[model samples]
Target chain A: MTTMVLSGNEACVEGALRSGVRFFAGYPITPSSEIAEEMARRLPALGGKFIQMEDELASMAAVVGASLAGLKAMTATSGPGFSLMQENIGMAVMLEAPCVVVNVQRAGPSTGWATWPAQGDVMAARWGTHGDHPAIVLTPWSVKESFELTVRAVNLAERLRTPVILLSDAIIGRLREKVDLPPSVPVVDRPRPAMAPDHYRPYAGGPDGVPPMADFGTGYRWYATTTTHNERGYPVGVDAAAAEGLLKRLHSKIHDHQDEVVLTEGRWLEDSEVVVVAYGSVARSALAAVKQARSRGLKAGLLRLVTLWPFPSQLISQVAQRIRGLLVAEMNMGQMVEKVREASCGASEVWSVARFNGQYLMPEQILDKLEEVRRAWR
Target chain B: MALMRNRDMVERYFRRGALPTTWCPGCGLGTATGAMVRAIDQLGLDADKVVIVTGIGCSGQVYTLLNFDGFHGTHGRALAAATGIKFANPELTVIAPMGDGDCAAIGGNHFIQAARRNMDITAIIMANQAYGMTGGQYSPLTPMGSFTSTSPYGHIEPPFDMCALAIAAGATYVARGTVYHTQELVRLIARGIAHRGFSVIEVLAPCPVQFGRRNAMATPVDMFRQLQRATVSVREAELHPEAIGGRAVRGVLREVEGPEFTAEYEALIRRAKGDTHG
Candidate 1:
């Protein structure tokens, strides 16, 4: 292992290259521009392709197309660009193309703050695309986890045959930290079709619910459509049964395997009265606040979410059942608090600690919320 | 003998049990699709090595009927997707078929930039004047004062000359043909696919149900006759300028050699790899 001080965005580039991503297509956007810049500089030297597309829509489309052509591809953008990418991201889901979309989030409802951090896109990453589809979203709080989770994101996307979103905030994206980089990390590639070209059905999944993909020029000759398609990869216009089966399989491919897809980290949860639920950059503040509260004779702990989507509901429920109150802290205006409340099933009082004014949720602020929740419990 | 040869070509290139296309009875997109398939067959291209990327429209359904691997993507993004396909595997032939709205209006930026970069792909713009799949809506290619579902007051916007836009955007090969000129359209498409850089072949396909019924031409034959009378070949126009009054010019508008995107990128990769002789 070698020690280097790198920002979250730089670490993500290293992780993507380590994960065997050979194609990078993107448009420049703030906070996420470093990822694209690093890719532009690093990819060509490694004999990979890097393209600066006309817009985010083209970037997303190109990434999906490259993935289908048998290359691990990615694109990075901010909120405005991520919103533009939603339609093609939906296309990626429908086509079952494996690619990674890194959204280094900045404040928005339309460019609210260009250079500041906010976790407002948590909900959009899950439901920005139209239709009922499965989503795998990974969040990282530290620079080290940024590299680790990006590798995980690429692996999960390839294994499940879906577009994975690495949702990072501005603070985490620009924050610098010294991390030990491994010489090599495990890489997973999309399963190639083992069946003969004549017998292969492109969308026919095996026991794992993931169909082996064939490259375009490899003689499989199977077509892929964004429209609802049958196992033969032909459009199933208004065929309710085929549509239902395809949609359900798309969902269950990731949902049924949540045990491997969902990941989280817990602190002081063995004997704690108040547990703070947090993710992304706000989790750093929550962890610090939990430690401070424990030192001050308060029974407090932190439940840091590494996988934001598939919501970690089971783990949240288990933690909620054992705690007196759950403090959900985030850099947004009460997005995941609702999910925490639902998962807790009224077993614990859920309090939302939000900060959406283009600033980090400081550890001191989270400590105040923890104190408030503790007093209310009494 | 001609009918037998055409039947053999269809059997060889078309997908089994995939025809009876979804196009309307009198749609000109069928003719355009036939011309494209014939061009591919004439060029002796391998079916397994070709990938057809299409956008959302009545014209986009052309890929579904072909035996080659295909991607039926969302509206107005076929060229962008095709660009990726070509870049990822330069050995594969990427053909993108898009409608007027899909090519010139919503996907205009991608079209221009693809040409500007001189990406190696063939783009067949089926310029049916209006959006036929969404009923009859005015598009950027819809002629001025043409009535449609969206433009009941007669479209005030001037239609874009797609061939000129492509030439100005630095396409290495550009051509235009009407669906009425089936043999010429096939030849143009074949040449476009053979070009080393970006090629745009705009086919003036008639949307009889949507574009013709609103205009004076109510029948498919009337629309075909109108196209035959309104367009002149580039050689004919040059020979007799008086014969080309306000008629649209057909045939190759631009063909020139320039650096192709993928080849240049490969050289850049070699240079980045510290190979001095690349």
Candidate 2:
């Protein structure tokens, strides 16, 4: 509909606005502050609410609260802020609030490098919170993909009644690119309660397993807690079976609908002997290396992951049989290589090309790894 | 029979079978809860139009006993949650119940910022002087030279004057009441709820089993008597500064006019939407 040049963070904010996000709460941090700054500037024009909370913890808590009150809410942060957000992230999961959390990741165990790129938070996004709950994480490799995937993240969050993380890194987040964005896109809203005021079950769903939500002022006044709850949204502590059922349901709602939740893109995997598994910013390099290797008669392929969590294990398992070897390239010290290795199940050799010195993985570096894997296979 | 049925006062507001409350007997939390219910009852607020958010603590469990749009959530984040609720639905009356430790220590940033923003919400800080739910840990509100489980020796830190902190942080309505004076607490709470700006009513409740048993006040009656003896009226406190060292100030400490957050936000929305008349 329209062509424009925008950075990944700018497109992220634009996409969120287009996706019906009206409430945004955030604390400023590097590489992700543009999302908050953009939200503050644009939200007022649209009559939406934007708040700069005192810290990341409150920012997350506010998002959960706003989502409960029936506005699609979001928050953004980098590594340290994302780490501080873990406590309330668990709360959002337990309460099943629909909100988006964007973590434009930077290199860090603790504030390692503020302005550099790294996929160090891949596992943290999945298991950072203190409990066993399902997570939906979407990773994007380009400015346009960041915009599009952010919109997708919001939709999935509302549809599933859970928190969704849009995992971007400094490389994609700061890099500017020209792209065509749609004039309008389809916006999906959470299901509304079908039952009467007196009979509404806020946590009960139909065949889809996602319950209709009610806002605070609605007549369906019910209690929500971090503790295990029944269908009526009341805490059902000490009842072992009820707790088990609730936990199982929370995981199954996302797992059972894997077709909708898991998304990936495969390039030249049909007849290639070497496949490179990559995501986020590093995927671009992997693509470059794949093309170079193909030109050199090495038969290399690229499998770029769009949805980082739910692992896309089925896809890897399916393609593992045909490929002789796989190279997993990322910005961290081999976080996702383990997943590829496990999914391959030894059908193919899994090699890692990880760089964590606050730098992006180069195409040549990826090509070098692919050459090594090719040599080993021969 | 003369009439159909009569229910107990607490039962009139509490959720059915959600009671047999877990609060310790001789704990002032029950009395404080009763005052809160009476305040809401006196204000005649609709249950469907109210939301009670609680942080993790003994105070956090209050939501389960009452019928309303309630959220019992993470430690020290009740105000943050309440802030969101009020922003989303400005017409709804949002209230948060938090403990001294939960509000002043863990959630201190939110408390200060919420007041600074003058957000339209009422926060009831239960000043029991110790962490009751966690087995009598030393809290930010524990009096100087007082003993608790964590402070096996006398606590060296001075307690926070919650009302003063709230007033300094720009709360429009700030007050202090004790469980010993239930009627006053109900009145203060109701008035705070009626205010359209940030309001705080700090209730000096007794934690007999956790705080009192560790300190010199071993019995609930002793705690109540101490509350009565150590508290001075607002007028008396101003007049007799010398004798007010060990005494707590009671009554409204601050009530002033200011722009309410929700009302201002509504006007912003109207302006943004190009509605000139608003």
Candidate 3:
């Protein structure tokens, strides 16, 4: 194992490669383009493949296709590019293909701040792709964390047999940190269809809701489609029964064992009246603010949420019973704040320190909000 | 009697009960579909190893009409899906078949990208020159000054020279032919599928119902007759350059060497793993 300091972008490449990613397809988009550029340089050296797709749509599709062919595949993009990837993302989800998408989230409904850091896509990463389906989102707060979470993203994708989104805001994506680079990391590849060639069914799940996959030219009679279908992968023609079954399988596949899937960290909860909940880069600033408030004898604690989706609601609700005043700090106007609010019981006072002006949430900005909540109690 | 159902692969793999298509009598899609299936069978590619992706239109129904792994993608997205399928497994014989409107209009961006990437697949554009699926709207490839439901006063846009566009965009193998030229069409299609790089076959299949009425070619037979008179062999096509330029050229128009998107991409991936980036 070689311990070296690596930028978040470089670390992401390291993580993906270690996690068995053999195919990467992406177009150069600001902030996120480095991921592609590095992949363009590194994948080939590692005996992997990288493609500069014509655009984000094709980039995303190529990865999906590669993953189906039994390669660990991924693509990276920023805000505008991610928007272009929505339709194909839905297709990946519909087909339940195992792949990872690294969204080095930037600001805007359009090309707002191309190179600037913003955590605005926190919510979009979970819901950007149209249609109702299960979403797995992981948020990394630092360069080291970026390396770790990217591997987790691929593992979750294969474990869940679904498209996993590694939502790294531009701050974490561009920041540099030290990571332990092992010669190899444990990567969980999907189970190939162990069934014989003739009886192979494409969408048949093996009790745990994950259908064993088979690559093309592997002598398996495989079927895959974006349309609603049954175990055989043929379109079931929008029948109410078929829709219900499809939705049920999609829902159960993720929800049945939410415990293993959902993870959150608890901080300073045993003795505190005021609390702050944050994720991504904002969580870093919020941590500094929490320590400052503690020095001021303000009785404040910070809950650094590393996993952004499957929203730590129950644990949040449990934490709510102890803290009275809470502040949620995030880059967006109030994206994840709303989730924190919904999860917190009315016993606590919850307020958001929001930023939608294409900027990060400064420690002072969040500290100011904490002061307001404390003074109001007076 | 369907030309398509007669093909060996199409005959063996077709959903037996799904046959007897709704195509108008003498519809050219049947002929082109026949050529495509013959090409597939002649190569002896495995059904699962070849995925046929089709966009919304009469041609999309060909998904069910053949036995290979098929995807009936949204209108104009056949090439995009085929891009994914082919790149996913460079071994898969992926094909994107769509009508003129589906390929040259709604899906124009994807079409150009696929060609430019030379993404190791065959794109067969069934250029009937009209939006035959929804209504008789004029398509981008519809001959300029031609009549249609949307162009009752005749079309105002120049038809796309699909083969030329493909050649310029970077497809290594580019050809154009019509259903009337079945023998040549089949051979060309087979060659295109067997091509190691991206290939575009602009098939001038006729849409009898929608286009026949608009252009005063009342029957599929009339459409075929027009093709026979308007088209010339790729060899003879050079002799009558002016005549062929105004009509169809039934043969390979471009076959050049270039980097294939998949091989280059694979090479890049291997290089990125620390090999080299050329």
Candidate 4:
């Protein structure tokens, strides 16, 4: 009943365990390696399993395989390895197999900075894999949230019967913070089809956008493919009908349930003129920036995203209409700023401050950007 | 031929029904498949407790024919997927089968790593020496000078010796055979399945329309006979690898190991938990 202080990395593994993640297969990469190491040590005695795969592709592929075999599975990797995993991530989505992936982002393009903090993967996690498909990504700014979000990632994966990505980064991954857990938390179980084999077609949708899953040995006969598919999970050739069907499901599955997927922590946002929009470490710095702005007699609020994908576009649009000038602070060359700009449109002047080197956005850096935007507007 | 599971008490439960596969005339996937079925049977693993995983290529379709659990994943990742499945439920017997191209070329990294770590599973590599499903492209295991769609002028790269790689990479059990020699192949597969660590049975299947057309064995049967002739048993392989040309080291090459990855990982968890409280 006693709560222990844990690092963000430690919380990730704890979250996975609490969520009933019995299988973790991954290859050790910088920033993300701690999650894999922790999982490797913990899964076995829990009546689970851990594997250090050959590479990121294999690590990603293994978790998807385990998910299909009726186990909650996960893998962790940083930016470079995450890129390698995109190919298989697409397959998991197409097959509608539920699995969790932890992407503890590092500096990128190549293995830019192996042991440094950077949030360059925010946009890459969105459109990294080929083709038009939907993704669920969560962000955790501290150790407690890392654990909580990792559990939520697994739950979302089961609820949606699709891959749910926990978007973490080097700063949050390595940062030591006090972690607290709820007295009680429920893990979402993946929905299993109750119909007999004859009545089963794996891809048939339930009332929710998710389809019921039938594990490999459960006497269910269903086809799963990356190609456009019909209700039976059989491949439909890529044509007008096929493309339309595939896109419709992809969009509807996530869009219709955006409220469940997108999460943001609103702090001092309701009555502020300028709102600092950020996620991950940028949000941490923005907190400091907002404090500095308020100390300087400026009305600055912080809107921190806990979920990156599904973008929380409606929320951004709503805030954009009220806020005077929005400041987007990030660690990439304007990756997340695009989302803010798109959502804000002409309602607010979207100001972006970003960097690509393996470094967190400093508090002063964000404050400077906010001042520049405010002066230009004034 | 459909299985007579009832007569043999084989508990006919591979999948929903029998297969009328779509392989070409005189293809050896059927024989390899039969060998797998018999191996699983011979092991007497609970049919309900088996999971067969496959990746893209001709062999990917094999999962559909089996009654046990099956995961047909993306190209070149059957082993990767099987590792995950094994970790999820260490009680289940997981098997991975992939074509030469799927395992060696596209999935080469996973294969070597799986063997190196020696995860508990049976991997049957159906080495037809060409990419069969994608209409005959050059594969990693395809012998140099073998003609394929991509290698019309003759494959320029040397072929990978799959069995040699498996043995070197620390597979607890390793064997080489061919569809040409079904009885021996099935026996090796069964032994591999029962070996309790990473086991690899490389089946030298004939790709008649693709590989055999240029590696140009006189016939599919003759191609198999070559396996019968080319291989030396483990004893002989240890003695004189050169005598049999050394490509087909056709018996158990190695069978010693530490505890497998999953069990060790589990033990670690037990230790971690014990330290926590009790």
- Candidate with best DockQ: 1
What is the DockQ for all candidates, taken in turn? 0.85, 0.75, 0.45, 0.44
Task: Give lDDT tens digits, candidate 2, residues A1-378.
Answer: 899999999999989999999999999999899999999878877879988999999999999999999999999999999999999999999989999999999989897889988999999999999989899999999999999998999999999999999999999999999989999977999888877878888777667788888888887788878978888777777788778888888888999889988999999999799899999999999999999999999999999999998889978988898878888999999999999999999988888999999988999999998888777767
Among all windows of 10 consecutive residues in model 3 chain B, the one with the lowest summed lDDT is B1-10
Share of reference contacts kept by candidate 4: 0.56
Stretches of candidate 4 off by over 4 Å are: A1-3, A216-230, A233-247, B1-19, B42-44, B214-278
The regions of model 1 sitting more than 4 angstroms off are B1-4
Q: Tens-digit lDDT track for model 2 on B56-133?
A: 999988998887889988999999989988898788999998999999999998999999999889999998999999
Top candidate (TM-score):
1
Ranking the candidates on TM-score from highest down gives 1, 2, 3, 4
How good is the docking of model 4, as DockQ? 0.44
Question: On residues B121-233, what C-alpha lDDT tens digit does candidate 1 reach at each position?
Answer: 99999999999999989999989998999999999999899999999999999999999998999999999999999999999988989999999989999999999998999
Misplaced by over 4 Å in model 3 are A182-184, A345-347, B1-11, B15-27, B71-77, B84-88, B146-154, B214-219, B239-245, B259-278
The per-model lDDT (C-alpha) reads 0.92, 0.90, 0.80, 0.80
**Candidate number achieving the greatest lDDT relative to the actual structure:** 1
Considering the two chains of model 3, state its CAPRI-style docking category. acceptable
Model 4 residue A209 CA deviation in Å = 2.2
lDDT of 3 by residue, B117-176 (tens): 777889999888888877879889888888899988888888888888888778899998
> What's the distance in Å from true for residue B241, model 2?
4.7
Any residue pairs clashing in model 4, and if so which?
Answer: A44-B266, B13-B67, B14-B66, B14-B67, B15-B66, B15-B67
- The 10 consecutive residues of candidate 1 chain B with the worst lDDT sum are B1-10
